[model samples]
Target: MIFHGMTVRQKALDLLDSGANGADVARRLNVPRGTVSYWLHMERSKRNICPGTRTPSCHRCDGVGLAGADYVYLLGLYLGDGHISQPTQHRVPSMMITLDDCWPGIQDEAGAAIHKVFPDNATCRVRKPGCRNIKVYSKHLLCLFPQHGPRRKHEREIALEVWQQELVDANPWPFVRGLVHSDGCRIINWTTRMVGGVRKRYEYPRYWFTNVSDDIRQLYTDTLDKLGIKWTHCTRAGKEYNISVARRASVALMDAHVGPKY
Candidate 1:
């Protein structure tokens, strides 16, 4: 009647396999319900009966609706600086976004967005030399982020699927906000002018998004076009890798929605 260690665990699992619930198995074996539940979970894991496989948690695979706004934001973060990796030791793939340590608010927002997009997964923060990497593990990362591939984002072509495009269209500001938070910045450029025989300084505020990938830059500019935000390509050091939003109206619109990274 009394079991110990693995013996009790095996007995609990056997009861569970026989269609008895955790509570019933615990009552019959005189073990705590929590302990019985733990045993069941471990047994399921051992048999590879994970929740991802059993219940279909992935929105894409299960045909369930995604957290659209959060997903679009995360997609921007992913396109800008996120990386997805599947380590040999891990059962699932992880998506990580590296953000500067100075911007804890942006870090928090990225973490919150990841959590909201994949509510069932766990997220962690890893600190590097001068930045923090926000990471989340999920089996369906590739399913959600179809742009993930073997090559670096800049080295490969990046395009959105029809569903993803629809989501971005529906929530343009959040998408822009995500990209800005990841790889864009609002800065001030100044010039000197003579007014009334006196030298005066004038400041102009603008938003700049710099990315080496032509496709990604095109995507950013295309989204801006939809929002009626005018952007110009800026060539730095003979390379055109920056998109500048300097028009008064466009800058005002960006300030109202995206603003500077906090």
Candidate 2:
């Protein structure tokens, strides 16, 4: 049985080396496509065929254009809750964004955005205790996300580059939506009101974005100001760490574009 397996594997590799795809090799060798794919991957690793050798599809290095809306949305997510890490010296770095498991729709959106930004790369989801991490590996992540550095995002200075600002300016709603999806929320507050000499209970909806990074909050408010959306700083636990959009007009605009996260 072992000799037969070795012969089949060798045949499969030979077929693959002759310029046939995994599907074609599997069909010809009467093996499962997944088996052929595994063999191909193992063979590449053995030969040290690193993915980093491939020409990076980077906007900075290759002068390639980004999917503007997707990039801006991803930028927002990264600034809010995303992280980039290099696992080892040899492997490329990966970018991860954690979203609550209850919001499968938001998870799908985040995955789609990552795929659009790095179409040539593969993305996977890693499940944690209460959230799912959508991640993609690439060598050019630093070039794409210049905010990555040695310290935590809130502890370091965060600012957008000129080109990134241009993209965000052109597509503000998506950027806001991304940020809200990550670290912001829409809630309804209730209060008592007197109407016609009678007491009544009324509820109003508002949007709130909480971020520890002052620069990140500034970026959010600056975008809001450009859109003519009124916002104020809300003090929480004796710290002004929240941006509130309680005005009816601003809430309506947020509802129209970004609604609550799914």
Candidate 3:
């Protein structure tokens, strides 16, 4: 009756079959109990089968939509609490990353496994001996390694030693290393960043400027206007400015907040 579109009564009668009980089957199959009874009544009268309501399953998500929308999340863990530098934090042990920082080529096999399996919006609570909860944005479900770095074994020596030496070397004046710190007291260092998209086998320098520069002069003037850094630029004594987190920004993620480096 359903296929041939013969009669409504016949279609209804056929809904109940096999060992299925009338009431339970009616509710499970989303048909009214009265309808199931009526169909049976009509079926007894006409002695035929009946069809029932039709429903389509969600093919896209296969019903996983009950949980959340499809997406990936990245969580950053720090060695110490980041709150000492910033006010409060949300979603402890996690920092949010914007989508643009991720590219398809970035994920490794291990990272892809998490992205494919972990539930969207599922929390990653970092609870390790030295773990710190510091979240950052990652569109590709990956955390950026600390660029303020000494955390990584290989870069431990280089981040502090080489970067410090480079920045001090950039200056014309001889400056003591240990005494050097930004106005906020974060250690002074050079940060290198390679320019993107060029086929050259070389990369550009990416480090903090520990010395005077025309760009930094403009920046100090601009920032001083806002933060009221009391000072005067003199042609006689010389131009010097404190490098501090309260002063300026850097291109490096960790150092981005570690500048006024003039």
Candidate 4:
């Protein structure tokens, strides 16, 4: 059986019992180092457990496999705009992805994707004064997204593990679709050009993905290359990379794979 799925304190004690360093647990769980220290002290002193504390009801079955469309899509979403966080004083371990509220279809898609990965867990959505978010509570989330840690995506060396690379290579469209949905935009480009001695205006569709993480950007572009989709990248003023797919043929392929969000 899994050694986790207990409350935060229990998980901390278990990790320590398993010989994991307190600092490593803190970083992995995105908790303050002091909090880990406190848990260790409390466990050592054999203090009375909190009255209401209980182990979570775990419906987890076999380990989640990574070779599925849902997993790849979720992976792209995480690489783009998703985040996982440790439990707070009033929360459970959760993973959340917030998308622009304007794209209701994309919001639904994100929720569906989350459900696809964690079929046993219930996914919830929030819509109000800000973007819409799809969130779910599960300690097993970290098992699926081990790349998770403290810090922004750009600050970390984000690279797919070997199994993930193989899965992504096998089926890349859904992964690309998820990343574009999260961090890219599809728009119509308009420009004027001299046509037969007269100025003419024409409109063309394009897709642009912008991110500060060079590794993620490279990963995206490399995936596009593997799919034979043409793209180009340029650096913006503030070091942000803009990867664009605007060529007629490239846009056609994107239309088939990464359509507009909403």
Would you list the C-alpha lDDT of every candidate in the order shown? 0.88, 0.89, 0.31, 0.79
lDDT of 4: 0.79
**The best candidate in terms of lDDT:** 2
TM per model?
Answer: 0.84, 0.83, 0.16, 0.73
Model 3 RMSD, rounded to 1 decimal: 22.6
lDDT of 1: 0.88
Q: Rank the candidates by lDDT, best first.
A: 2, 1, 4, 3
In terms of lDDT, the poorest run of 10 residues in model 2 is: 47-56
Residue-level lDDT of model 2, residues 37-119, one tens digit each, is 77776776676553522244888888877999999999999999899997687478899999998789999999999989898
List the candidates ranked by TM-score, beginning with the highest.
Answer: 1, 2, 4, 3
Error of 4 at 56 (Å): 12
Kindly list the per-residue Cα lDDT of model 3 for residues 1-262, writing each as its tens digit.
Answer: 1222335434444555454557865676566777667666555445321112112112122332311111111111111112112223531123322111122222231133234333332423343343322232222222122223224322233222343223333421212111222112334445355558644453322322232334333433344334333334434345443333222332232243322223
Ten consecutive residues with minimal summed lDDT in candidate 1?
47-56
For candidate 4, report its TM-score: 0.73
Clashing residue pairs, backbone N/CA/C < 3 A, model 2: none
